[model samples]
Target: MSEKLTLHKYQSDITGLMIEHKAFGVFAEPGTGKTPTSLYVVNHFRQKTLVIAPIRIAYSVWPPETKKWSDFNNIKTGLLHGLDKEQRFLDDSIGIYIINPEGLVWLESMVAKHKRFPFTNLIVDESAKFKSPSSKRFKALKRVIGLFKRRYILAGNPMPNSYMDLWAQIFLLDRGERLGRTISAYRNRFFTRGGFRGYEYFLRPGAEEEIKDLIKDICIFIKATDHLDLPKLVINDIRFDLPKGLRKKYRVMEKQLFWDLDEGKILASSAAVANSKCQQIAQGFLFESLSDKQKYDKVTKKVYDLHNIKIELLEELVDELNGSPLLVGYWFRPDYDKLKKAFPKAVYFADSSKSEAVQIEKDWNAGKIPLLIGNIASISHGLNLQKAGNHVCFYTMVWNYDMYDQFIKRVLRQGNDNDRVFVHRIIANKTMEEAMIMSMQDKSAMSSGFLNAINLYREKIKEYDE
Candidate 1:
């Protein structure tokens, strides 16, 4: 039998705040029980709610969450995704209709065709995805905002890139009453363009405080550290030097934008492409083609193996763990392939079928899987694996702040049984891997716009003089 649902004091307080405001933003970190707290609000009103989340979360997270807590037993959730979504939409018994952000386009069309919207409340999980005003999902939701009487947005980092991200998300709640009527108005009011080609927007003096004050009534920012007594998180940077021959090749590629391999020439068409290639070399491999075709056409493009230092380091780390479950995050497909080859016992999360993935997750949480490997982009959100492990190793670094943050939270969350969580980062010294880590750290500290963060990252890389 499931245990009785009990809300933490902070959750209860947030619930009250949500109920009182009707339309609000719950900027609570992962594992902070935002889902249950929102469910409590939905149950209190007994209203039909529509939740927008990532596809994985829509299909896996919400329904189980409702069933997990006895307090939410009364809440019925139907996933409106995949081929059977239309059929599922016809079910009137579902109290909460869960759909991915992209599904909003279809939902908007349905509302227009039917000339009515059924949901009384709106809940957007990971609302940061809708931060862009120009995004199709945001536009779709804006068209039907009036259909929902009570609106709420939930996110751990709503402003994942910059404060500019808050405009569209906050617009969904109060229809731009708190921020501005449009993104341009919001930008003009709070920011000035300062970065390269006048593209990056920086906040003006006192704009942060003014903006915070305006949205203070509707937005509640909650940090997990402040509320949850989670275990101590220890981050370890395991640095290694690239092979001398590989090091020379890495510099040539960085300077010339192209490198000649015995098989074919590896090209970096632009700065971004060069950065990606640099990261690949740092991880000990280089792909023949710098095109998207390489991702799919496995037969045509050749992947040259540069070094095995990272794999060797990872094996050592696993040996040190002594058979304990270790969650490993990788970036590129080559990285996953190499990790799997090195540790044959490891299971790749993305390579598994639906049923297999479900079983893998079960085995992982049950402490049955020893080494679970996953692409950070794939498993960054929705799934919970904190029950079985407290140790995470980044086989390769990632540039996206949101993915990196969510990846760590997967293990360091509230349900872990351990008193400490260890995060091991395998970085190549004087390589793009170091630059990527520095970029992530700076972005986390500054919370600047994405492009601006990239520019800052490039400046840091230049200092390396590779």
Candidate 2:
């Protein structure tokens, strides 16, 4: 007997809409099953599909999703990345070509010189990455977007930072029919320049509504709350104060924008460099030299570690969680190294080898590997870590609001078996970490206007259903 396929009412609705529209964007929030919904449409149509996604997703997500569900098991899939890319291209056995967004230009180059374009449809995962019209990926993809008989854009938070993110994304779908053909035209219609000597453009009054309405015809917005019967999320803000000496050093770095440490062997002499130095200090450690710092140019001095305050907090969290698996989102290179040393058996998501990474993912999901640690930027957009565990710890916060918003969904999203997930933010009190969190929150608020529109549509649907 064939396997049964069951999807929620909203999932069925969006899948139906995709088949009807042929080309559209799905601003479905995380845990809403955008992957399965898109796959269903592709299965029904049986067209050769091109999926453009971030490197992590393109490598680990799409192929796994296809394999997990028997519903789409027969559809052939190939990954266009790394050394085996040419083989994947020539396989002729696969119907789906998944490529990283960064490689779109190279794909264009391939088609222009020696290859033929084969995909009849395009699915741009993490469409927000192409929010900028001037980006090389978007420009390259635009030249051939019309070649696809169908196209779909997927993003959990579609407009992560600003409404400006909407223009290029919408353009790829409707060919600038909904938004203006040119970015400048779109900007002039809804924004006015006002910030910093008229260099920045802020949205004019009611511009959000106008922009929302323009794209509503071809876009579907699905909220996780309305669709998924999900577990509760528990968030803990664990804040700590720096030691007296460390506090003084941080103050010097922040105020004077310079610091002399280790007998002039290490120095932070500029505002940007000082910012990195101070943030590192807040985390209970600092590289011995500015040259070894990632945020700025490296100095020639040897790197040194100052403390392990946050590491101590992580140790406490580990003890508190007992023996359960935990997913830790470490933000810095040093943090990853330190975390691996502290949690010896922990599995890290890395770029060691493609097959090994796949095996690591399988091991994690199968409950064999506990304490999985990954950089937030590396694992943000895609990859299903929900099965591993429900506790997600942010050892360090990130600057981009979207990454913070997306990273949590790994465990909080649909298919998670746990009853409730815990999200921990180990914050440094009175430091840049606090400032970074606040800045992200403020920027995230910019999406409330779009969410309001989504709420209104849901209400209209609820009334009709009643």
Clashes within 3 Å, all models in order: 0, 3
Local accuracy of candidate 2 as per-residue lDDT tens digits, 1-466 = 4444688999898888899997888998787888888889999999899999888777777887788789989988998888888677667678899999888877887777766887889999989989999989989998998899998999998777678889999998999998799999999999997533455567899999998898888998887878787779888888898887777677666543322321332321122233576677777667764454675555654546777888899999988988688888977677877787887777788544666666776777788866778889777766676777888899988656778877888778887878898888899876666655664555453433323332343333343221
Q: List the pairs of residues colliding in candidate 1.
A: none
The TM-score measured for candidate 1 stands at 0.89
Candidate 2 minimal-lDDT segment of 10 residues: 262-271
User: What TM-scores do the predictions have?
Assistant: 0.89, 0.85
Indicate the TM-score of model 2. 0.85
Would you give me the overall lDDT of model 1? Answer: 0.82
- Write down the RMSD of all candidates, one decimal each: 4.9, 9.2
C-alpha lDDT of residue 261 in model 1: 18
**How much is 175 displaced in model 2, in angstroms?**
1.4
Model 1 poorest 10 in a row by lDDT = 261-270
